[model samples]
Target chain A: MNRKVTPAALALAFSTAVTLAASPALAAGDKDKGDKEKCYGVALAGKNDCKAGPGTTCSGSSNRDYQGNAWKYVPKGTCKEIPSPTSPTGKGQLQPFQEKG
Target chain B: MRGGGAGAGLSERLRGAGGLTVEERWAVALLDPEAPTPPDLTSWNGSDPGQRFAVYRNNVVVSLVESLAQTFPVTCELVGEEFFRAMGREFVRARPPRSTLLARYGEGFAEFVDGFPPAASVPYLADMARLEMHCLAALHAADADPAAPQVLEAALREPECLPALRLRLHPSLRCLRSEFAVFSLWDAHRGELEISQVNPLAAECGWILRSGLEVRLLPMCAGDCDFVEALARGNSFGEAAEAAAGDREFDLGRCLATLLRWGMVTSVNGIK
Candidate 1:
């Protein structure tokens, strides 16, 4: 990274990495970025956007990486260009990933 | 298994035989340890489910109280752990968690403290607790990009648009006015001031906010507090300044410089 990623980004990465990466069903509730769509497999564990899953006891509590249900708000056109270590295609996807390994 | 026994019908009547829904039974059972287990819990039974129910009830209430203690650390510190735990026990039983957002756990605790006789000796404690709660809220609010200095300058160049220009303050901003020196007390507890010499009678006014992910609690004078409060309450810059005029020689330029310097104003909207 060329610049400081920010504490907020680190926290965001930790939270969005969970269920939002795994399940697409819960991603629709969030309406913060109207022009953005749910980008999966991009948020690192504990970096998911918005609220955590059902067992989320506290704020920003994601403990898993590339969580299928966890998602990030990516510009509508840029999701596929982003890289994901866990995604089968080695890049982010607009919808939830079907992890191969 | 009742062999036409009249007792069977009475017990049945108590457990949904007449009216209580499954959810109601479970909810009622949680509050009253003596109540029979809800019809849905079919896992165990050496005898009456009251013992099992009591165990589950204790765990739930204890966890909720623990949540409160975590949410209001300052409040817990003020009353000591044991006293706060006891108070939390009573608080949970009286007013249970209505929202699932644990981050917002103690929203009503200040109100509860106001009515609690044991805590009445320290009348200002509730307001202090309220301040702490607001601090938590500010820390967790959404991220917003502040309006650049040039943006403010451009808006000011057109004074006629001032009243219509709605300033978008940072999402984490909150103003609080209180009778006690809560900012000092909170600061003292945090090692910013000496707790022993801090006076409780001194009135304090301030706002709590997060600047670039760092939560800050800053004290303000009467005029500045009222000025910001008016704007936060939805008054335009012109209207907010006009409302704040009664607050002892309010200085608009100084207040504007301070607000702009701190990056509190995010985006100025509402002009055609």
Candidate 2:
């Protein structure tokens, strides 16, 4: 309850940090590399980077109808390794991630 | 394009469409396949209006599911595509977009995943989705020039004024705290680490900041997370420092240094 950060501590922190603050920002030339280094692919499938309007709901593309709930699919991702308490063995298990009817 | 009588009659019927207009009915039907096609609607060639309506319905559902996939690719990857698509379909149908700004769509997908019964097995999936959402938001956030070193130097001159100083971080900077090792999990997906190396149950703090066009996800210590949160909430430098100082691992100088090194400090104010 009696936490207090003294001005001396603040001054010391700022003084040490000032050197890093003095460094220059990244130059314009890095923009290309920056663009390339983005974590996710810039051109994701059917994604236009928020530029285009919402996908046309009325488009007449005749795709096969996908019916039924996602219950048939189980937890098949990287989370398979994550420990789950629900597993009877008390180890990571590939549990069916759906509510059975 | 249809004959005047049929089209006009359809319009008249739509006008008195028992509380819901034809367009609204169709819009609703687009998301729900079980919903019947609007009455008296006909395709150009008259080749079964239901078939034509089904195509549009498919596009609406698939495109929205695709958008959710793109927005939460990691979450999608975690559950794999097939399951992600199915789950996304459920999310799309349950929470249809009310805004045309597709960029902001799927903002609630994280919360949706959290409560989704199917995803109960993967508890961290929601947090991962939330992290991905923050990354998307950071990528599109407004740009700001980082505060220069002179600002810190000016403030440093008056040591007593230091406690009251408030810092303004870049708009794109975001912090996340999770009971799971969400940062390590995400980093492993980036190929920076192996899945075997991560213990998902371990708690972790993460920071996302856009330096130039790149959105960087960096691991943070518990102390640094508290420090950033306090400062973000408009707590004075002293208050934030005190909050972090409680943790023995915290180093005020290093945290400040890293903030500047990443060009995250946009402005320094509250000094006389």
Candidate 3:
């Protein structure tokens, strides 16, 4: 399949593409508002106050075992939004969304 | 959950073993929950420094986990809050940030998810993580101006120079090819489509770039993906076209239209 597209063919295709690309009709996909609205609360995660060190006043606490390897939890987020291939009814049969404890 | 005393014991063991500084020991104890509060640590409240250290340790780990959750919300959403936090906690403990650039933290998380055991059920979770990371990177990538329409129009005048003309894409442009319908899954999350309507097994090539103030995900055929990647690698128009044409479904005109319309082409070079 080494048959190269001739120079004429390449030129024709590229010119046609350039013309089409210039049309405003093709720009309909540009929908994102460029604002942080979607990433609002999420972006705040890393921007926490840069305290000199961890302060005793910062009351965040999570005591779960870090190294323990056990798989009792299953995906129950938007994954539930997808229909399971295994479901006999062809509906979303995944578990209910498990709220944070 | 070993106490601050265990940390002190480990600190002593390390000191006996030799060569560690007080600061290094303090850093290690802060991230490791089982490690005791550093012996040198003192509290202002006159309460036990060990208990205070425990609070500090928890805060440090929680903040890092929170960062991971923020950067990979889709990953968090896919696994649910509890599982994601648990997995994030494990990740935070295993791999702490090396640089103070918190925004760039968790760059390796996608790869980490690929090898993680608990995430094995959602086979596409790793790819989803990768897509999320790419989106964030694109969002923060340096800005560049797209080639003006006149530049491309002028280049079109010299048909013979087409093969030599190289297109420069925007700095934020990122393309990814995934075996899973990762683009669809992301699109589903973005509210463009219902998640249940997507087939997770469908292979897709994702095109991402921050055009103007907005980051956009453009749908691409396999040919378009290969074409853009070639151009991004500095291939000329003819070379990229040839590569793209290898796919039977290649449509050069449509692909070019998409790139130009999205403001992806920053410059058209080597055209005399």
- Per DockQ, the best of the predicted structures is 2
- For B146-218, candidate 1 gives per-residue lDDT tens digits of 6764665565455556555577677788888899998899899867899988898899888898754346888
How far out, in Å, is residue B243 in model 3? 1.9
- Model 2 docking tier (incorrect/acceptable/medium/high): acceptable
Ten-residue stretch with the least lDDT total in model 3 chain A:
A65-74
The two-chain DockQ for each candidate, comma-separated, is 0.02, 0.29, 0.25
TM-score of chain A of 3: 0.30
- Candidate 3 to truth, TM: 0.76
Query: Clash number for every model?
Result: 25, 1, 3
Chain B, TM-score, each prediction? 0.85, 0.92, 0.90
Query: What are the per-residue Cα lDDT tens digits for candidate 1 across A5-101?
Result: 2334322322232223224453322223666766877775544664346655333454466765567766778888878887888988777766657
Off by over 4 Å in 3: A1-3, A28-101, B1-18
Our tally of clashes for model 2 stands at: 1
What is candidate 3's lDDT per residue for A1-101, written digit by digit as tens? 22366788877887887878766666544433332121111112222111112232221121221101111112234323443333333323222221122
TM-score on alpha carbons, each prediction: 0.66, 0.76, 0.76
Full candidate order by DockQ, most accurate first: 2, 3, 1
Candidate 1 positional error at B200, Å: 0.8
